[model samples]
Target: MSRTMIAALVLVGLGLLTGCATSKDELMPTNGMTMQELWQQGSSMSAGDAGQQNIAATRATLRRPITSADMVEEQTRYTREAANEIHSQFSRLPNPDLVIYIYPHLAGRDQSVPVPGYSTVFPLYQKPHYAMPGETARPPGRTR
Candidate 1:
């Protein structure tokens, strides 16, 4: 390659290396302040004030007052979220009781003893207990 092209490539490589060498402090300007201090400085304005401003802006942008349609939509959304939570909880629980009935049939070719038809019943889990949300799951035969 030409001398000028080589020098240009070297400079570009140096620039890239320097860019990658940036420290966390350099990336985020905390102004030599502690995390709490930085947070306080950044959040000088009260959250209530910001919320009010957003509410005012929304009110200004809205052409009409909220109607029954909007209320119904929000109610439906809440209902769906509640139903989803119930479904998640139900799914986390163990399966229900199961029963199996075997039909009366002949025994082996030797025809030793006839196997009697019977019904067996057993729970999906020995201990049908459920864990609350955010709780760790316990294995069978283990108790918390």
Candidate 2:
């Protein structure tokens, strides 16, 4: 009971403190000067003309376009050899596709909906077979 009473008092005190903080609606004046004017006054006192010029130069540098020259790491990531390896590493083995042309037919349980003539494709194998690295039997056209 005492713990519950203490929690309730803490909550009430917090509520009163927040209410007091929000009660005043007027914005505090900075000696009749705008907020931007006050910030300019402070910045002028802390930094010299050279420091301000350096900031302007930094802003100009930030506006430049991003390119390969800006890259910090090695440039070997997107080379031709890397691209070829990516394509050849997990190549699927030869699997001939069988296409069957279906004539226009009405297909429905109750309503006879006419399906347009279309060709459906099915792989000769049951599932895709990826060639193992350094396998004895590689795909026909693969030079490696």
- Candidate 2 residue lDDT tens string, 1-144: 699999999999999997778532355535678889989988987589888889888998989877776563345544558656644665667788999999998889965898899999999999877777655246444633
Candidate 1 positional error at 83, Å: 48
Which has the greatest TM-score?
2
lDDT of 1 at 59: 84
| lDDT (C-alpha, whole model) for all candidates | 0.72, 0.74
List runs of model 2 lying over 4 Å from the truth. Answer: 1-80, 86-89, 124-128, 136-144
Native-vs-model 1 lDDT? 0.72
Overlapping backbone residue pairs in candidate 2 total 0
Which has the greatest lDDT?
2
What is the per-residue lDDT of model 1 for residues 13-61, given as tens digits with 9 covering 90 to 100? 9999999999988788767789898678666654578767987888888
**TM-score for predicted model 1 compared with the true structure:** 0.25
For model 2, name the residue pairs that clash: none
TM-score of each: 0.25, 0.30
